[model samples]
Target chain A: MTQSAGLVAEAILPTFTEAVELHKSMVFSIAWHFLRDRSRAEELSQDVFLELHRRWGSLRSAEHLVFWLRKVTGNRAIDMIRSRKVRPETSLDAAAEPTTLEQMHDSLLASYLERMVATLPEKQRLAIVMRYQEDLEPDEIARILGMNVSTVKTNIARALSLLQAKTVGRLQPNTARRLNEMPGETGK
Target chain B: MTPFEQELKRALARQQPSADFTERLFARIEEEQAAAPVRWWQRIAQWPAQTIWALAPVCVLILLTSGTMLYTQHRRAVQGEHAKQQLLLALRITSNKLQATQRQVNEVESERQPNQKDNIRRLL
Candidate 1:
């Protein structure tokens, strides 16, 4: 009863194993998309959970647990990128801009988007991953990133515009114009 | 949501890592715990929060009772030393008074001896 989700207000918290089982996908996916390397993603995500295990004493509730998981994973991934100065495997700078997202298979498009997101500035990349991958609101992203809500919004908008510009280059002129004309702050 | 935004969200949707992610994670946690430097109190801290809560009052009670026992024992030892000192002072005073009384008795006997010698000479 205790290891299961705590239905009652005073219920015992979930065990560490249960927490690991429940949140592995979310944690792994964030690292996977952020780092764009399967092996490194596995390592980074595992490190995050390991950290959670060590700090399990201070965890207050399930919600707090999720917050910690996201915050730690995001910060660690960014720190890893900065400390190592890891550039994208494929050069977004030198490679041909991806102008054919329309005809690309869904899986291909997804992979492309993942790669592009991984190449963004560390802060912008984290903001985008947390924003889209976790489906978090900007305020939540700001809290996780320790940034102002406005700064988070700006990062997301700027990242979105960059991806849009690169991906939208091959779109029908009208469709591209419509996407551009639409206010991009959908996240706000 | 714009189509572009929708695509972005869809692309970034959470996916499971390799099948053994949990097993690997648990193993890694174990490895980390083993590798970390040992601190005896930190072991207690790592216990489940409920366990900590359940044991807290009992721990406090134990500490309080032990502390009080130690304090009482120390006070008794100090009092015992004080009583021993008082007894020693009393004994010393009694011995001094006895010595003074003995000396007075010896002086009276010596005075009587000299008087007796004067009386005997007059009789002769």
Candidate 2:
């Protein structure tokens, strides 16, 4: 190892470490929300950080670094899912339901929705995850995903509509009647 | 702000990875950095070592192809030589048989000539 290159790597090491420390939440959360598996998410986020460290020179600013992290992490997650052909354990249509809306706690409902999101087509699932998890705009997601803004919006909208329909329309028989009778029942 | 969309947002909100996530990441980073080539010379030195596996099959393929080609040419040459030797032997055998037949014919003619001479001498 030459002295100058060793010095360069040593100098850049702290910056890379700082980047990982600062953005680990965002990067880790993206994988977790997408894959819904903690170990896999952790493994994937480490890989992303390693990649970020490798490409540190190309990144221009803090924002660009974040952008790079998001783009790479999202793409990697999508690629992993595609390669594994991994899907949610059950489709909303096929899952056997023993719990009613009233019986499902808030976290349980959230879990259900998260699983349902996993069942969504890849684009729609990613769109939903980025929008809700990262709070990214449709255009921002479009830029990250290399899709038209309208396409991103369509994916999010369709995913939301599917979630709402599956959650609301499939309520218990008496629960649906009671909820329908008592309220405007927009179910939005 | 609808209840369901809000619920969706709540469902999808980002959560930090496990508490040791950063620690594990840094540990791995440090391990990789330690293992990685730190300089241009180091990279050059490691290059062949890394790619030796990939290059091995190509080298084997080249050797196999060249060996087959050389063997095929040598076999063809050997076959041609064998055919030529067989042809020469047959020609030699044919010449020898023709010469032997000619010698026999000459001897028979000589023997007949002597008999004719004797008969003529007797007649004289």
Candidate 2 fraction of reference contacts recovered: 0.48
lDDT of 1 by residue, B53-82 (tens): 899999999999999999999999999999
Worst 10 residues of 1 chain B by lDDT: B24-33
Per-prediction TM-score, please?
0.70, 0.62
- Docking level for model 1: acceptable
Residues A13-55, candidate 1, lDDT per residue (tens digit)? 5788878877788888888888888888899998898788778
Clash pairs of candidate 1?
none
List runs of model 2 lying over 4 Å from the truth.
A1-14, A172-188, B41-124
Predicted candidate 2 versus true structure: per-residue lDDT over A35-148, tens digit per residue: 877888888998998777666655555566666888899999999888987666787678666556557666877887788887888888888887877767788889989999
Predicted complex 1: DockQ: 0.33
Worst 10 residues of 1 chain A by lDDT: A1-10
DockQ each? 0.33, 0.18
Please list the Cα RMSD from the true structure of every candidate, rounded to 1 decimal place.
5.9, 11.8
TM-score of chain B of each: 0.70, 0.54
